[model samples]
Target chain A: MSVTAAKGFTAAGIAAGIKENGNPDLALVVNNGPRRAAAGVFTSNRVKAAPVLWSEQVLKSGQVSAVVLNSGGANACTGPKGFQDAHATAEKVAEVLGRGAVEVAVCSTGLIGLLLPMDKLLPGVETAAAQLSEHGGEKAAIAIKTTDTVHKTSVVTKDGWTVGGMAKGAGMLAPGLATMLVVLTTDAGLENDVLDEALRAATRTTFDRVDSDGCMSTNDTVLLLASGASGVTPDHAEFAEAVRQVCDDLGQQLIRDAEGASKDIKIEVINAATEDDAVEVGRSIARNNLLKCALHGEDPNWGRVLSAIGTTRAAFEPDRLNVAINGVWVCKNGGVGEDRDKVDMRYREVHIVADLAAGSETATIWTNDLTADYVHENSAYSS
Target chain B: MSVTAAKGFTAAGIAAGIKENGNPDLALVVNNGPRRAAAGVFTSNRVKAAPVLWSEQVLKSGQVSAVVLNSGGANACTGPKGFQDAHATAEKVAEVLGRGAVEVAVCSTGLIGLLLPMDKLLPGVETAAAQLSEHGGEKAAIAIKTTDTVHKTSVVTKDGWTVGGMAKGAGMLAPGLATMLVVLTTDAGLENDVLDEALRAATRTTFDRVDSDGCMSTNDTVLLLASGASGVTPDHAEFAEAVRQVCDDLGQQLIRDAEGASKDIKIEVINAATEDDAVEVGRSIARNNLLKCALHGEDPNWGRVLSAIGTTRAAFEPDRLNVAINGVWVCKNGGVGEDRDKVDMRYREVHIVADLAAGSETATIWTNDLTADYVHENSAYSS
Candidate 1:
């Protein structure tokens, strides 16, 4: 199940020939519903893709009937012509669905600074339009993948309503917002205001905390569409919980499929003076090259962990800090503690707990270990 | 010529079993001068080494007679005992040189979170003092090498006076003093105030611009000692220029010796709205993992260059930015321009020029390409 797992949505993926490899490169998801309301989160990078610039405008209108997406070419840094291509994509989707251009959002991912093949992409939109079906969510998810090894989807069904979503990303995955393209669909009769509030809150905690490779994307976009087909108005708190669950699941999938990573590391910062301090400490550890390398080697090198934390400005006394790796407190009071030999590293998941010993706040950020494969994959090509 | 190239200075290197491999791990540089004026710079990292904390106090006294350095272990994150160890090392040097303890400076590098072996280090200082000579600069430089394959030193002789320096760093090199340990000595008859001004001005542009691995150390220190034995005062502007040249030369050497790096990359950000903008953009490009990997593979991937620049807050128009790789304008007006194949990557140096088209300010940051060897060296064991 993907975007179409919720009621009143149809999706399709088709070969667009945009990629020279001739893989499926076009995807369309239509909200054929009694209510067309949506919310969106986009890349915070200053250099945005043309599609992000266009979708930000469409979301301002507080309505979205469909989304058009493609792979093989990220229409970023292509100047006026790139923006025109994205606008044309939205216009074509709106024309096929008998809606206004402002009601459609577009996303593109692949190599940057290149223009898309509008000749094929625009016509391929028509093919996807013709084949739109409620059971085509998986194909839509697969079409948007760049280096992702697997298509990701999640669904949370309540008593009478359901929330479903699909996401695609594998590299250039850092917060803000991980080069990911995602679409979440729900059939609970919520207004545009409710959808916008819930989307921002869910994304801030879920997608915003996953830092796969410490590279921010220029084409990250996550759109949440409400169709109101089930006519079951769930409680606001319950609806938000369901949406968050799907987002959290998709974010986990993104980290699990991160490029060339052998282990998934979860950095949990506890006893921070504030939430910001916790986040700062967590991010510092997540982006540390030496620490990530040691994690890949499974050395349980707590020294590197302390060094990474020392680089951050988080509030904590140097001698009061504590670090535990996989339930073994290898470092305490800023010195060597338990036997590092007791720390086992036989699993795909590594849990590192950094206790600041300053306050009661805590936060967790997920990242991956650095490996030779990461260097080889990143150096071999322009992906 | 190294730290002892200047008049009235003596240096030595010795081994006292501090390093398990029995390599020389102790160095001493003494200024037996008519004027013992000095200035220093230390790591800006919040978590500083014990030696850094000790030397910062020494510099505040505005005079330095000697500097003691070691390569076997960094007294960082070792708590109060570490601080006491650094103090005792300095006191030992002071006793041997017949100077006050407050007039001695200390520097340490190697692993963090471990205490130094005082039994080995203290006796090693006495051995270094016994063998000190004006011709022992090269030996002192070699003693400070950790992963550096070659020792680095620079000399500049003026009319009747000379300036000389030595630096050692192979990894954990980044801005905030470039994770280096350096010592410069001059016999130019300059006072402490003059030395301080010139040292800060020189380091601001030279050492602060090299970002080899985007990792800052907790024990980075650069010290300048003035011995007025030549008795010839150079012009203020000329003196600062000479200091800057020595720093720039040593900084370049540090980058060349960076661990596992196959290519030296110079990222030049030109035509920015302000000097800060230029430096920010230059540093962003220097730290980009994807672009570094692309350079390692000898692929002229200019799109990655643009993507890296987009992640910065520097003033630039997406449609007006231009990029040139090794004299080939591969990207112009934020889009593809020259044929990427025209660019050559056969050399060990790759120069990237980014034209922001916003103003006249410019800056350049030096970095190194990411390689599989980098991963292996950093992952094989914790430093």
Candidate 2:
């Protein structure tokens, strides 16, 4: 299962002179199919990008056949001009593919509020269209990245059904609905309602649980398209689980590639009175910069963990909470229980478990350790 | 004014060996007057620290003669034993000062959930008692620091009345209520109710508007003591404003001293429909790490400003919002309108203004720019 493995899909990526480094800055994915059923989830931020606003309205018809994405210049905050540029790109893609403009989706990332270089972007789109191929998925994935050191792609397969996805986001991640740009493709037939349900459920625990820096993005979007090429549609529960698996995998990759992050951390909260409470507890810890930095330094600072958990409204007596760092129980019943020296956080993966001793509810959040590199990358980002 | 500038107060600082570096860790502040009228505030976190819990109970009587604070171990989650240590510390202070144990307040800050070093603490208390003086405020301020680059102090005087305070907190300073450990002294003759009202009002607009990293501490406490030695008490309104001024000054100093901070940022939200709306908008921008980093780099990233403002429930039309970074109107009517490069951010201070176009209500928040030093400081902490 690959981004272009689905039937009737062709993809291409190329250097568009948008990025300073001249890396692949343009990507295009096309659907040369008889069916166009699409759904998209956008950022919950009220201050949305012009492209997001345009696509949000366009996707209301539940039909999308192609997507045009570019890096190095986020066509956001450009107002009417930005909106027109997005519409023009969609029209250009539709003209080349002999489809209506409304059937095309557009996504842009990079420095915000910058106007797109349409001279380069239009020709780049043409070049991408001319070079479109089924094996272009990997290149497309590499084209949409900003500070990410690695490309993220995932695919799920089960009994004649396939779901492939590619995502790009390294910062401005926090729990809400979506935090980045993701395109998912499936060859299995799915009703609009089924797709919506599966997408929402998949995002609830995956993309919605990643808080890299607790900064929500304005251009975050996730689109799902079903081609029904496999002629096999699993039940709703099964299909939802498969989609969740894909989202989970992609979400993990996003965290691993977080800006200046050297380690991926998982914060798990268990035995909460309610799922929301558990999630709140987990997210609170995930968003704590001090805790993230301490984890980056391989310091088992259980005090920060307890302090973070204490800020949440979860129903747990402080003394009844047990905390484990790196698989070593450093705190039990709200007191020092294990030797601090026993916890080793020298690797690129760190895990923290908190038992609330209330009920059988749990939540796990993915995050990245805060480091000087993160500060450096972000501090100098806009310059 | 200094910590010891208040009449009838004696203070001392001593090394307790609790910190590995053997820095001055134990501090004592005593009120020698017969009237022990005190008002206090604790952290807003539901998970109270042991010292917070003990002090909360003691402050219920509105009488406190002395406060004993120790840095290096914030005995927050040490369970019953932690509470015992706090009580024992207060008892030792009371015994040394010949006051009732119930009249003593205790506070601790540093790593959490560790047992107190009884040998070091007890001897340190004795040494502090022996060294107590009317001019030990600077020493006490330096004693209760953890990762703080400098001490914070503020004083306000009107006529024959005086109010002075010292605060210690550099991080974990998001607002629920209070975010640091502060002690205020006054020689004005005021009742407990007046002091309480003034303290609450001052904290609401001061400490409550500072968001360093969006993390709230468990051991945050603020104590206000009035010795009535000045034999002069101004009107309640005038005294309250003075207290607010002092708190505001200290709050600004705290933001300036934020870990790895290179610039102090002020986010002002104006034309909100209500005060709450204005505060929410201000806080959203103050908590955005990307925006903070952009400020650190002196880049006028108005897109991040809009995205952050969009996260709040403030009743404002997105398209009607206007934004200015460092006095340069970078965005007008929710879109870029001015030359972003015209904004100058070469100074250590920054000002961001968001016009909601709803009403006349306004709120301002103080924050710090994210920097590599912040990451390094927090990452290496506890290591």
Best by TM-score: 1
Give candidate 2's whole-model lDDT.
Answer: 0.85
lDDT of 2 by residue, B125-241 (tens): 999999989899888888988878888888887898788888988877789743578999888888888999999999999999998888888889999988888788779999999
List A-chain TM-scores for all predictions: 0.99, 0.96
TM-score of every candidate:
0.98, 0.97
Docking class for model 2 is medium
RMSD of each: 1.4, 1.8
CA-lDDT, candidates in order: 0.91, 0.85
Query: How would you encode candidate 1's per-residue C-alpha lDDT over B1-383 as one tens digit per residue?
Result: 79999999999988878789999899999999998999998988877889999999999988999999999899887888999999999899999889999999999998877789999899899899999999999999999988889999999999999999999998678888887899999999998899999999999988999998788888999999999999999998999999999999999999999989999999998999999999998888887888888899998887777777788888898878899999999899988788888999999999999999999999989999988888888888778
Poorly placed runs, candidate 1 (over 4 Å): none
Clashing pairs in 1: none
What TM value does chain A in model 2 reach? 0.96
CA displacement after TM-score superposition, residue B125 of candidate 2 (Å): 2.5
lDDT of 1 by residue, A53-121 (tens): 999999999899999999999998788899999999999999999999999999999988778989999
Clashes of 2: 1
